[model samples]
Target chain A: MKSTQRNMRRDILDGLHVGIPIAMAYFAVAFSLGIIAAKAGLTAPMGFVSSFFTRASAGEYGTYTLIAAHAAYAELVVMCLVINLRYMLMSAALSQKIAPGTSRWHRLLMAVCITDEVFGVSYAHPGYTPPAYTYSAALISSLFWALGCALGIVAGNILPQQMVTALSMALYGMFLGIIIPPARKDRNVLYALAASFVLSGLCAAAPVVSGLSSGTRIVVLTVLISAVAAWLKPVNTEADGEA
Target chain B: MEKHSVIIYILIAILTTNLIRVVPMALIKGPIRNRFVRSFLYYVPYVTLAVMTFPDMILVTPTPLPGVLAFAAGIIAAWLRLGLFAVAAICCAIVYLLSMLFAG
Candidate 1:
């Protein structure tokens, strides 16, 4: 029993060591997200609750857009699901990393905080990951994420209009940061990204498709573009770490 | 948005996102074997984020010029593989600078 306690404590400390950097990064990004939430008319408390529970930038961004549009609840559901579908893949990958016969509750708890950065660090662990490690990492990062968001909203309310306008682009910058690295490595990703940009631009301008709500357009385009890319350039799961 | 509606939306966001994360980790034990499904999932983030970034990014700013220029700067910064915070900071700085230039 003493050894088990020692091991768990070590895991928790290790988690914190890795988690601090992730926590800092999340605070910066979540700050931008909070600013966007403020633009969408969300109160600081609202931003805090949203980030605390969701912990997903892209998903929350879509949700804010839907909220601003006064979109239907069904639209919100589908948009959240679609924007966050990548988490499903990440979670599946993580499921295999947990030792067999680990408690189901631990798996659920770990899953609750599996953002991209957290998953990256957790999956890099040498052997089967201890639940305590992930729990500690998640706890530190999630608190920062929520706090940064609430503080961002408060700051947004005080900052000048021009500054807020500038900050609004931060989310897009982060999105570019995400997609561009992969595009730089893979030709297929670059092509898919370029195609998405062109098609999305066209859809916004075209007569009928332009009429679709922004949330609906994003969902439709994501499915359509990704499906075609998959059909045309099916990834070799054995070779590709991304899958 | 009303206070109640915002609360409901936040709940929906939480539930839907957690469902995607928890269900697979809790239930699925094996790697998905289907090649097409794997490929599709692999491409989803790039496509979805790319779609979201363009057009909307340009439209979000007060004027088109600063938005366009800042976007180009952002793409360059990101293409160089700057950290997300750095890229975002660069974009925000560029927008602020250019907007001031245009305003003056």
Candidate 2:
């Protein structure tokens, strides 16, 4: 019991090390989402609630776009579903990192915490996060995300409109920060990204394909465009990542 | 109209959101052996993010110059490894400054 307690403590510290920067970055982005939501007729409290389940900036913003159009709930549901579908793929890739004996309950818990940032940080961790530590990571990250949205909504509401409009760019900037790290270190990543542009652009222009909601198109095109990098499996030589 | 409907609506709203966000993550375990599916899952994020950001990088202003300059600003900020917050702040500041200089 004492050993397990020590293990938990160690995991907690390790989780803190990983979670803070990612969560802080996430908070900055989510704050802008809240501000935008406030501008879009959502209250600060509603922004907080909408953000909890959305767990992603692009999809949440996209859904807000639909909501502005006064699109139906079905559209909202599909918008969120299609945009967030990548989480399923993310979760599957993650299952490799988790040990096989991990229980259904544990899988469910980890699944709930499967935000892009969480997956990104977790995947790149130096070692396997003990199942013991996963909960703390989830709790800490979720709290930061939810708190950030709350801050954005409240801040967006109180702050002048000009400032809120300015902060909206922060989300795209966050994406640049994410992509550049891998892109700089690996030419292969750059190629994959460049291909994403061509494929997504083509997918956008084709008349038959272009009519679909942006969410569905994202899932279809990204899956197609990213096939090269993923097939080559850049990080696969490390056996530990697979098992 | 019923008074309790608002409470019901909120519950429904929260429940609906949770269902889309959380339910499948609980149920979907799979064989998932096909190389295409496996690889597709892995790179979905990179491509998805790229597609999302492409427009911003491509078309920032009515005239291409301001937009092109903002594009350069973001590329430089990102290449410098300034992290997420700094990249965002620098890009926003540069855009606002440029807008003031040119658009005004």
Candidate 3:
């Protein structure tokens, strides 16, 4: 078991090497989130807690601004629900990685750590995820994410307002980083991104569909894009380490 | 009616979101065999990020010209595989300079 522990640590380190870039990519958006929190009159810690729990920048920023605007509780409830609803797909995809035969206690812990980052990496590698490696990677990535937000919040609090405003592109740049590397290697991925963009834009531009709630629009777009991509290119991802 | 009660409501809302995200996977633990489903699952993050980034693009001016320019600059910087900090710095510099030129 001692040797097994060493092997697990090594696996985590391997994951860390890959995950560091993911966290660095996340910093720009996470920092932007801090700026949003400040504008919303939320304390820095309040902003940090959003990342700590959800690790989702868009939803966290939406919640912060909605609260700031004194938006309706019912609307905020729906926005939160719809924005995060994609995680359901992420978690479902990650289910293939964990030990299917395990007990509820194990599933409970894995569920807590299943962010988009973890889910993306875990799904890309199908098969038996050594519990130790998967959990440790999640713990480490979550820390990097949470710590980045905490630092960004503190920075946003003290920075000059103009200086903060200049950072609007940082989040886009970060997302670009998260996506471009993968898309560069695969035309299918590129097509999915392009299709999703045009489709979503059309949805927004259309008069009738434009009346739908923003959250509903987003969910619809996600489902549409995923469905099309799945139909275009099928992948059998039942086994572990297939990618 | 109190402020504390409002905070509690927010927390519960957030918790509900987390639960909705986590519960289905806990129960659904079979091999995903649909070829199309697997292919799309693999590509979803790219689409998701692209979708999320569209509305969030920051604009420093009424005209989208400068923001568009900055967006192009960021993509170029990222394509060159610049570090995250460098990509951000370049985008902001372009935006700051453009804002000065246009507004001044």
Candidate 4:
């Protein structure tokens, strides 16, 4: 029993050590998200609540966008589901790494914490990952994310208009940061990005399609572009070691 | 949006995202074998984020010139593999300085 407790403590500490950098990165990104939320007229408390519960930047950004657009509730639901679908893949991958016969409750608890970075760290762990490790990492990261978002809304309210206008660019900058690095390495990603940009622009301008709500338009484009790219490129799971 | 509506939207986001994470981890222990499904999931993030960023990026700023300049700056900074915070800060600074330069 003593050894088991000691092992759990060490795993938690190790998780914390990995989680701090991820937490710091999340805070910075979540700060920008908060500013966007403020621009959409969300209170700081609203931003805090959203970030605390949602804990995904792209998903939260979609929520703020739909709110700003006054999109229908159904549209918001579909957009959130589409934007966050990647997590399903990540969770599946992580599930495979968890040792067989681990408690179902533990699997469910770990699932709640499975962000991209959290999954990356957990998946990289040798052999089966301990639930305590994921729990500690999730705790630290989620707190910082929520705090940064609330503080960002506070700053947005206090800052000058010019500054807020500038800060609005941060979300796009972060999005670029996400897609650009992968584009640099992969030709297929670059082509897909270019196609997505042009298609998005056209969709926004095209007479009938342009009439669709922004949330619906994004979901449609995401499904269309991803499906075509998948059919054309068909990533080799064996080569990529994704499975 | 109303306060109640905002809460509803946030709840929707929370539920959808958590469900996506939880349902798979709890229920699916085996790797998905379908090649097309795996490939589609791999490309989803890039496509979704790219579609969201463009056009919207240009429209976010007070003026088109500042937005265009900041977009270029962001692309370059990110291409150089700067961290997400750094890229965002650089874009914001560019927009701020340009807005001041063009202000009456």
Candidate 5:
């Protein structure tokens, strides 16, 4: 029992070390989220609480967009589901690394914490990951994310109006930061990015498609464009092993 | 939205996101081996980001020129493989300057 406890402590410490960089990364993204939340007319406290409740960045942004537009509840729910669909895949991948003996409750707990960075870091673990390590990493990274959101909200309220408007541009920059590097690396991603851009633009502008609610337009555009891209350039795992 | 409905919105967001995360992990064990499904999932995030950013990005700013300039700066920085912090910081600064110059 003593040995197990010692091992658990060491693992958790190691997890914290890995989690620090992730926390820093999330701080940048969540800071932008804070500004956007404010622009959407959310109170700082509400922004802080929502950030605490949902760590999914894109989903939170989508939620804010819908709320600001006074979208219906069903629309907001569907938009969020679409925005956060990636997490399902991430948790699915992480599930494979967890030991078979882990309890269902533990799996559910880990699922709550599975973000892109957490899942990526966990995948590097050579064998079964201890629950302590996963939980510790999740706790630290999420705490930083929440902290960053709170800081951003406070700063948003305090800053001059001009600066706040300027800061809102950072949200788009953050999204570009996410998609650009990968698009540069792969032709397929480049093609997919262009397709998504043009299609989304058309959806917003063309009279027929523009008539749809923003929530529906976004969902339809994302699904159709991504499906086409996937079918056009299916990533052959056989060719690029472990990509 | 009413104060009460705001609570409902937040809860729904949390519930849907957590549902996706929890349901998949609980049901699927072992790496997904199917190439088609893997490819589809892989493309979802980037495509979603791309679609969400455009049009909205251009419309968000007070003027389209500042918005386009800021977006161009971001694209260039990201193409140079700058880190997310650097890209966002640079774009925000550029957008602020351009907005002041043009919108003033």
Candidate 6:
């Protein structure tokens, strides 16, 4: 039992090494979110605390916009649900990769921190990921994310106007870095990405669909484009370690 | 809004986000067998990021020019397999310089 505990501790540290890069990316993104939260009248602590609980980026930002506009509570809830529903698919995929015998509580904990970057880095891991490693990675990544939000909120008060505008691109750069490597390696991913881009452009420009809220458009377009890509070219992901 | 409403908003965010994430892991114990479904899940990470990034990136910046330039720089650097730090730094520099030049 002692040896097993030692091994698990080792796994968590190994996970943290990879988690650091992801944490850096999250820091950049959350910084932008922090500034937005401040602009929306949220206190720094309120913005930081929200990052701890709900790691969803677009969902948090969307909620801020709705609250500022004084949208109905029901609409806000439904919008968050739709904006964050993609996490269901990601969590389900991760469930298949976690080591067998991982406790229910550990699984529950992991589920709470399933951000886009967390899932991406974990999924790209070659084989069966130990529950401890996954949990540690999520813990580290979320910590940095929350810290970034707190910093951004604080910094928003003191930073010059032009500097904040420049800093916002850090999040965009992080997102682009994440997708480009995979899209370059796989033709199917490239197609799916193109489809998403075109669909997003049309949804904004095309007269009829243009009426939809940004949240609905993102959810609908992601599902439609990914499904078609999967149907047209299904890659076997059975190489995932199942220990 | 009242000061207390912030707490309510955070609660709502936590409840909704975790609902989707937790329910799946709690119920789905094994690898899904359906090829189409598996493929769909596999493709989701990429498509979700792509859809979220575009259009949204354009809107976040003060003007289309700086955002577009920054986005183009990021794509080029990332495609070259530059590490995340490099990608972000390059894009931020480009956006900053362009905004300074044009929006000045």
Query: Top model by TM-score, which number?
Result: 6
TM-score (C-alpha) between model 3 and the true structure: 0.79
Candidate with maximal DockQ:
6
- The list of candidate 5 runs beyond 4 A from truth reads A1-46, A61-79, A82-86, A89-110, A114-141, A148-155, A238-243, B1-9
What clash pairs does model 3 have?
A126-A240, A126-A241, A127-A240, A234-B35, A234-B36, A235-B35
Residue-wise C-alpha lDDT for candidate 3, range A75-178, written one tens digit per residue: 77778778877777677666666766766666666776766566555555536665555576676666666666677767866764444556566656666655
Best by lDDT: 1
By DockQ, the candidates rank as 6, 1, 4, 5, 3, 2
State each model's CA lDDT, in order: 0.80, 0.64, 0.66, 0.80, 0.74, 0.80
Report per-candidate DockQ. 0.57, 0.40, 0.46, 0.56, 0.53, 0.65
By lDDT, the better pick of 3 and 6 is 6
Candidate 5 TM-score to native = 0.73
Pairs in steric clash, model 2: none
Candidate 1 per-residue lDDT over residues B1-104, each given as its tens digit? 54347788889999999999999886786555677877777677677777778888888788788888878888899899876667778888888888778778
Each prediction's fraction of true contacts recovered: 0.79, 0.41, 0.48, 0.82, 0.69, 0.78
Instruction: Give candidate 6's total backbone clashes.
Output: 1
Model 3 segments beyond 4 Å from truth?
A22-28, A39-41, A71-73, A99-106, A121-158, A208-214, A236-243, B1-6, B58-62, B73-97, B100-104
Give the per-residue lDDT of model 3 (tens digit) for B39-86.
666666667767765544533435677667766777677677775556
Per-residue CA lDDT of model 5 for A93-143, tens digit only, reads: 577667877888888898888765566456556587777777777788788
Instruction: Give the per-residue Cα lDDT of candidate 3 at B23.
Output: 90
lDDT of 2 by residue, A1-243 (tens): 999899889977876666665566667667777666655567666666666655666667776665556556665656666777777666766665566566777777676667666666565555654655555655676667777877886765576443444455565676677776778877777888788777766766778987876678777776767776777764443442463
TM-score, every prediction? 0.75, 0.77, 0.79, 0.73, 0.73, 0.90
For candidate 4, write residues A147-206 as lDDT tens digits: 889988878557677776786676678678777887888899899999999999899889
